[model samples]
Target: MDKQIETELEAAAFRGLLTHLQNHPEVQNIELMILADFCRNCLAKWYAEAAKERGIDIDYEQARDKVYGMPYAEWKDKYQLTATPEQMAAYEKRQKEKQ
Candidate 1:
């Protein structure tokens, strides 16, 4: 495929992922960190970086709001759950494995 078409397809896929994540509020960021080593926060950071690369000014919080479909604090208050012991252990193990 050409570059333009490829970029559009990639953008569409990203939107789909964002929509899926928004629909699944039960999927905690910690769980994403443990399993995929990235979460919505990471996506927000990446989004910010991309904006910077294109000479756009987007802060992390702004990018996070776009990713979360709301302010991060509000989303956290509404959807974030305390991690279980098992989840913590897995997260720790994943961190260790990364280093």
Candidate 2:
């Protein structure tokens, strides 16, 4: 594919993934980290980095909003739950295994 077409396809795939994630807030970030090695916060960091690379002025909260489909605080208040000790332990084990 041409470079522009490739970029557009890539952007579309990203948007689809973002939309899926937005619709599935029940999927906890820690679960994503344990399973996929990254989560919405990782996406936000990458988004901020990409914006910086492109000389765009996007901060972490803006990037997070893009990923969360709302302000981070609102999302946190609504959907984010405290991880149980067992969940945290499993995530830590997964991270160690990855390393």
Q: What's the number of clashes in each of the models?
A: 0, 0
Which residue pairs clash in candidate 1? none
Model 2, 19-71: lDDT tens per residue? 99999999999989878989999999999999999999999999999999999
Model 1 scores a C-alpha lDDT of 0.97
Indicate the residue-level lDDT of 87 in model 2: 84
Which one is best on TM-score? 1
Candidate 2 residue pairs that clash: none
Q: Tell me how far candidate 2 lies from the true structure as C-alpha RMSD in angstroms.
A: 0.8
Q: Give the least accurate 10-residue stretch of model 1, judged by summed lDDT.
A: 16-25
> Where is model 2 more than 4 Å wrong at Cα?
none
TM-score for each candidate, following the candidate numbering:
0.97, 0.96
Which tens-of-lDDT digit does each residue in 1-99 have in candidate 1? 899999999999999999999999999999999999999999999999999999999999999999999999999999999999999999999999999
Off by over 4 Å in 1: none
